[model samples]
Target chain A: MPQRIVSQRIVSLVAGLLFGVGLILSGMTDPAKVLAFLDVAGRWDPTLALVMASAIPVAAVGFALARRRGAPLLGGSLRIPTRRDIDARLIGGSLLFGVGWGLAGLCPGPALVTAAFGIAPALVFTVAMLAGMFTFNLLFEAGSRPRGVAKGSGTSC
Target chain B: MELAAFLPALAGGALIGLSAALLVLATGRVAGISGITGSLLGPPDDDTGWRLAFLTGLLLAPLAVVALTGRIPPVTIAAPTGLLALAGFLVGLGTRIGSGCTSGHGVCGIARLSPRSLVATGLFMASAAATVYVIRHVIGA
Candidate 1:
C-alpha cells in the first residue's frame, strides 16, 4: 500500500536534511559551542540545554502520536526499542561516549555534518569513528548478524 | 547565552524534533545518526539505499543553507587533529557499545520515555559535564 506513494528514500532524505540543518542552525555543529555548553564549571552556555528542552516537547508529541497510530504511516516494520533492563554496558558505554564528547565536543551527528562540509579534521574524526564502529562489529558480532537484519536490542545507533 | 541565542536554539530544536518525528511516523525508523552511519558499514543492508539517501541530504544541507540563506553557520573545532581522532574513535566505540548517542538517547529515547534511555541520557550528561570540568577547570587543559 505504501509503495505506491513516495519511497522510503525520499522520506529519509528529507528527514536527514531537516536534522542536519537543525544541528547547524542550533550551533550543534560547532565543537566549541558544544564544549561551552558542557563546561558548566567554566564559561557555561545554556544554549544546548534549551535546544534539548525545546526538542523534547515536540518530539514527545510526535512519539505519542506514532504510538497511538499503532503502525507507521508508511507501512513499514516499526522498530522502536522495547528493552527495559539497564545494565553495566549501557552505563559504562555512555560514560565513555560522554568523555569523548567532552574531550572533543563532537558526536556522531554533528561530526558527519561537519565532515560533509569538507573539513579535513572532521573527516579524520568521522573516519576514525567509523573504524571504531567497524572494529566493534567485527569483534562482537563475528559476522553473526546477516546484512539487512535490524539490530534491535538495548539501543540502535 | 543572550536572548537572541534562544531563537535559533528553539527553532533548530523544533526542526530536529520534527524530522525525527516524521522519520518515525512515516517510516517506523529512528533517525539515530550513529545507527544510520554504522548500518552503512560492515555490510550492505536491505535499506542501504534509503540510508544513503538520508545521509546525502545531510551532506547537502550546508550547500542548501548557502543557497537559501546566503550563509552557512560557522563551525569551530578547538581540539587538535590527534585529539579529535582519538575522540572520534572513542565516540565510535562508545556509541556502538552504548547503542546510542546524544540524538538517540537524549532526544528520541527520552521522547519515548524509555527508562534505559533516561538513565543513559542522565549518565552521559553527568559524565560529559564532569569531563568538561576536568579538562577546562580542574586540569585547565
Candidate 2:
C-alpha cells in the first residue's frame, strides 16, 4: 500500500510536470496567444485549435486503453461519473468557463500551469479559481458526504 | 502540420493520461483536480498531504521549466481582473453544482465511459464554444 501511495504521488507529479511543460511549449500559457486565436475578426490565430485537436486523440486513446484494463496502474477501479441528464448548472458552468476563456484566455489548467512563468495575470486567475472553488463549496456544500461514505458515493444516478 | 506545436500537446496529453492511469494504479484515487482541491479545505487529518503535494507540484512544475528554459512566455488578459475573478467564481460554482471539472468529467470520467461524464463533458464543451462565440462576436467583449 505504501508503495502504491508513492507511485501515485510520482505519477501525479509527472503528469503535472508534463502538463506544465506542454502549456509552455504549446504556448497555451500565453493568454495573448489564446486571445489572438479567438480574435477571428482581427488577427485570428488558429494555434489553440491545433493543440486541442491533437490533445483530443491523445486523451481519447489514453481513456480507451485505461477503460479496457478496467483498473488503473496505481490501484483503484476508475470511478466514472454516472449522471447523464444535463441541467442548468452544466449549461451555466460551460458558458462561464467559455467567457473566462474568452476574456482571459486562461482556463484552470493553463492558468495554473503558467503561474511558473511569473505572469501577474496567471496568478490572478489561479487565485480567482481557488476562490471560486472555495465559494462554490460554501454555498452548495456540494462534496459534503456522510462520514464513512466514499468520496463519490456512486449512489446518485 | 506545425510539428513543433503539435508534438508538445500530444506529448503533454499522453503524459497526463498516463499519469492519471498511474495514480489510479498506485493509490486508487481518481485524478480529479476538483476532488483533490476540495480535500484541502476539509479536515486536516483526512490524508490530504498527498493532495497538497500534487497541487504544489502542479504550480511549481512550470516554474522549474522556466528556470531551465531561461524565460517563459508572457501572459496577457483581454479583460479586467474583476471580470476574471467573477468568471473563476462561476466556474467553481459550476463544478460544485455539476459534480466535477474537466479533468474529472472530460479526462477520467469519460475514459470510464460513464454516461454522466459524457453528458457533463458535452455540456462543458458546448457551453464553452457558445460562450466564446457570444463573447467574441455577440457581446464584443
Candidate 3:
C-alpha cells in the first residue's frame, strides 16, 4: 500500500508537469492565443482548435485502457464524474465559466502555471479564483463533500 | 497556418492527452486541474498528497522545459488586473459549482463521453464565443 501511494504521487507529479508543458506548447497558457481562438467572429485563429481536437482522442484512449484493466495501476478507485442528470447547475455554471474564460484566457491550469512566475495579473486572478471557489463552498457546498471530489466528479487544477 | 505552428499544436495536444491518460491509468483519478486545486483549499484528505505533487509538477513544468529546450516559453496576459481578478473568481466558483474546467470537462470528461461533460462543453463553448463576440466585436473592447 505504501509503495502504491508513492507511485501515485509520482504519476500525479509527472502528469502535472506534462500537462503544464502541453499548455505552453498548445498556447493554452497564452492569453493572446486563447483569446484569438475564442474570438470566432473576429480574425479567428484556428490553431487552438487543433489542440483540442488532437487531445480528446488521446485522453479517450487512456480512459478506455484504464477501464479495461478494471482498476488503475496505482491504488485509488476511479473517481470520475458519473452523474447523468443535467441540472441547472451544469448549464449555469458552465456558462459562467465560459464567460470567465472569455474574459481572461487563463483557465485553472494555465492560470496556476502562469501565476507561479509571480506575475501580478496571474497572481491576482489566482487569488480571486480561490476566493470564488471558497465562497461557493461556503454558500452551497459548506457542509457537503468537496464539491469537485464528490463521488462521480472528476479532478482538475 | 504555418507548419511550424501546426506541429506544436498537434504535439502539445498529444502530450496533454498522454498526461491525462497517464494519470488515470496510474491512479484511477481524472486529471482535472480545477478539481485538484480547488479541493486543496478545503480540508485535508488522504487524496491530498498526490494533488500537491501534481501541482508541484505543474509549477515546475517551465523549469523542466528550460532544461530540455534551453529556453522557457513566454506567457502574456493582456487583460487588465481587475478584469482578470473577476474572471478568476468566476472560473474558481463556476468550475467548483459546475464540477470541472477546460481540462476536466473539455478534455477528460469528453474523452470519457460523459453526457454531462458533452452538454457543459457545448454550453461553455457557445457562451464563451458569444462573450468574446460581445467584448471584442459588439463593445469593441
Model 3 alpha-carbon drift over 4 Å, by segment: A145-150, A153-157
Question: TM-score of chain A, model 1?
Answer: 0.90
**Per-residue lDDT of A68-136 in model 1, one digit per residue for the tens?**
897888786777887888988788888888888888888998999999888888898889899878877
lDDT for residue B97 in candidate 2, whole number 0-100: 55
What RMSD, rounded to one decimal, does every model reach?
1.9, 3.7, 1.9
Model 2, residue B92: C-alpha shift (Å) = 2.4
For model 1 chain A, the run of ten residues with the poorest summed lDDT: A148-157
- Stretches off by above 4 angstroms in model 1 are A1-6, A146-150, A154-157
Per-model DockQ: 0.75, 0.42, 0.73
lDDT of 2 at B53: 62
The 10-residue segment with the lowest total lDDT in model 2 chain A: A148-157
The alpha-carbon lDDT assigned to residue B51 of candidate 2 equals 70
Best by lDDT: 3
Estimate every model's Cα lDDT from 0 to 1: 0.82, 0.62, 0.85
DockQ preference between candidates 2 and 3, better one:
3
CA deviation > 4 Å runs, candidate 2: A36-44, A56-72, A85-88, A142-144, A147-150, A153-157, B1-5, B44-47, B139-141
Q: Highest TM-score: give the candidate number.
A: 3
TM-score of chain A of 3: 0.91
